[model samples]
Target: MNAFEINGLSKVYENGNRALNDVSLTVPKGSFYALLGPNGAGKSTMINILADTVRPSSGTVSLLGHDLFNERNWCKRRMGVVPQEIAFDPFFTPREVLRFTSGLFGCKPDEAWLDELLDRLELTVHAGKKARQLSGGMRRRLLVAQALVHRPELVILDEPTAGVDVELRRKLWDFMRELNDAGTTILLTTHYLDEAEELCDHVAIIDHGALLTAQPMRALMRDIASSYLWLNYGQAVTLTDADHDALAGLEPRSSDEGVCLKLGRSENGDSTFHQTYQAAVARFGPPLDAGVRSEDLEDVFLRLTRRAGGDDAAAECKS
Candidate 1:
């Protein structure tokens, strides 16, 4: 059964700006789903709607088989949300903050579980420190802990590792993996493509409030099995008509450095491409230094979203 299902979902601002358009997707139970898009791409809007923080202008949201709008309280009880903004009372310590959150959720406070959460998040030492006393990273960790305190079946993390270091980010990834392994579903939205590529089972890309594509991560990569080859030359080498014809199947484009060839699956097999590429380099002589690499999720993301249009693509690329 699907953990969450959004059908023809949409949202429009009071000023008449449409933030989300006819977006529909399903997330499987216990899966780590990553929602990728540019700033103002409606990622947060979708998340906020799911968290019951913002009501959708139209369409339906069903979570764990319960209609979100109809069974509002039940949906709220089953979902945990860690929003991008970390808000807290400056005077409240982590312990007090978590205790208050639990109270709001009507969950009995468990000191042992709270301690374990703090330890895992590496915030145990800061447990007694007020929110204002903690660093930015520490506060982010505290927000995650706050979301998990009630032990909801599904957790939504919006830019959870935005300003975190590599080590802590990896630690958090492992922790999230552990939670999903134990049957907790995770829905993540982040600008970090590497994290999404490494951790997500499913990925959905949206732009201009429209759903561009939603597929299993493996399937998406396989569907676009094209490697973007970057080549550098000590001296600029002008392309001959025959040279362009030789690699006709692959679309080759020139940049300031040298050239880039986008090799699709039908163009040449991996082994053949390597052999042909090396031969071309040898024939081109001394100046050319060629490197062939696979196209990662980031590359596919850029290509797909750029085709969708708007200035948001440029902003997302910069991010």
Candidate 2:
């Protein structure tokens, strides 16, 4: 069964900003899903609606076979959320916070499970410290611990690493990966596209409150026909107006090693690429070598979301 099945979900604010516009999407069970969009793209609105914090204007939402609203308790019990902002009480210690959250969720306090979470999340050392006294990364981990205290089947993380340091981010990723591998469904929203690409099995791109495409990570990369060719030049190259026009969309930029040019054979053929390379060599002398790489998720994301400000498309999920 799908972890989340949202159909024609729409949300309009009091000021009439339609945050979600008849959006329909399904998140597969036991997958790490990335819900991506720009600011005000209805990502937060959708997550809030799932968390039952924000009411949608119209549509249906089902989580883990429980129709949202009608079986509120069941659905709520099956989902956990790490919000973009810190929502913990300043006075409560990490242990107290977890106890309170589990109680609020109507779950019996499992001391063993709580202790395990504290140790794994690296909050054991600061478990007794007041939340406000902890470091930023520790506090973030505390939020994660709080979310998992009740052992929800679905966890939604929104920018969980926003202010976290590099080491903590890696640690959190490892923890999340382990949880996902253990059959937990995770939905993550973050501006860090690289992280999403590295960790998520599936991706949904949305903009202007509409879902542009949802598919397996590899399929999205395949949809884009472009690649990059990095030219390692021994010296600098000068470009005339004509040379620039011949290499139009490539937007060749210089790097420490050399220059990088965008290449797409389907749009313009191999002849264009060779001509550009020759022009660079003639102008700057011989190039050390060239490296080629396929386009990545960030490229696909920018194209879809930017175009979705007024247009859209549908892509099948390759589950």
Candidate 3:
């Protein structure tokens, strides 16, 4: 069964702003899924709808095979959401917070699991400290612990590592990986594309309140055949007229290493890298080193969003 099945999910604000538009997506069970978008791209709206904090203008959502609207309590109990905003009772200690959260979920406090969570999140030393006394990173850790206190089946983390230090972020991801390995479904949204690229197996990108694409991470990466090659001659190399002619079609720009050549796959099914490298080597007389920078999530995101936006604009003009 899928972790979440969202069908034609659309959200419109009272001000007539459409947050999400006809977005349909399925998050596979036990998979690390990433829901990515730019600022005001309806990511937060969709997430809040899943958490039941925001009501959608239209569309249906299912959580773990159950109709979310019909079985709100049942679904809520099985889902743990870490919202972007951090809010807590200042007087409550981390221990109290987790205990209270467990009670809210109709679960008796699991002391052993609680201890393990605190230790794993590095919150044991501050377990007794009031929420107001903890630093930003520590408070974020507390939020994560609270979310996992009842060991929910589906976890939605929205920018869980935002404002967290590097060391703490590493620890947090490690803990999350452990949870995922133990058969928990995780849905993550973050501005950090590298994190999504590295941690998530499946990715969905939305822009202008529309779902652009949703596919396996590997498949998405493989579809992007464009790449840039960086060559290093160990020193500056002047581009002669011959070198310019050979690299005419390729977008060559000077780099610290030597130069960078933008390459796109040709229709003849020739390896662009081989052709470009040969042309550079023929003139530059063999570089000290060479590296190919393949298209990553960031490149894909920018290209899709810009292209989609242009298409929408053109459609409006024609209409």
Ordered by TM-score, highest first, the candidates read 1, 3, 2
| Per-residue C-alpha lDDT of model 3 across residues 35-154, encoded as one tens digit per residue | 999898999999999999998888899998899998999999999999999989999999999999999999999999999999999999999999999998888888899999989999
Q: Tell me how far the alpha carbon of residue 239 in candidate 3 is from the true structure, in angstroms, after superposition.
A: 9.0
The clash numbers for all candidates, in the given order, read: 0, 0, 0
Q: Tell me the tens digit of each residue's lDDT in model 1 across 1-319.
A: 7889999999999999899999999999999999999888999999999988899888998999999988988888888999999888899999999988888788888889899889888888889988999999989999999999889999999999978888988999999999999999999999999989999999999999999999999999988535655567743447778778876755555556666565444354334556556645654643346666676788788778874443222222110
Q: Each prediction's Cα lDDT score?
A: 0.83, 0.82, 0.86
Error of 1 at 290 (Å): 4.3
**CA error at residue 3 for candidate 3, angstroms:** 0.5
Candidate 2, 1-319: lDDT as tens digits: 9999999999989998999999999999999999999898989999999889999999999998889879998888888999988877999999999998999899888999999999888889898999999988788888899889898899999889988888878888998999999999999999999999999999998999999998888777766535666677654445567766766776665555666666555453342567556666665567788666555676678667674332111111001
What C-alpha lDDT, on a 0 to 100 scale, does residue 171 get in candidate 3? 88
Candidate 3 Cα RMSD (Å):
6.2
The model with the greatest TM-score is: 1
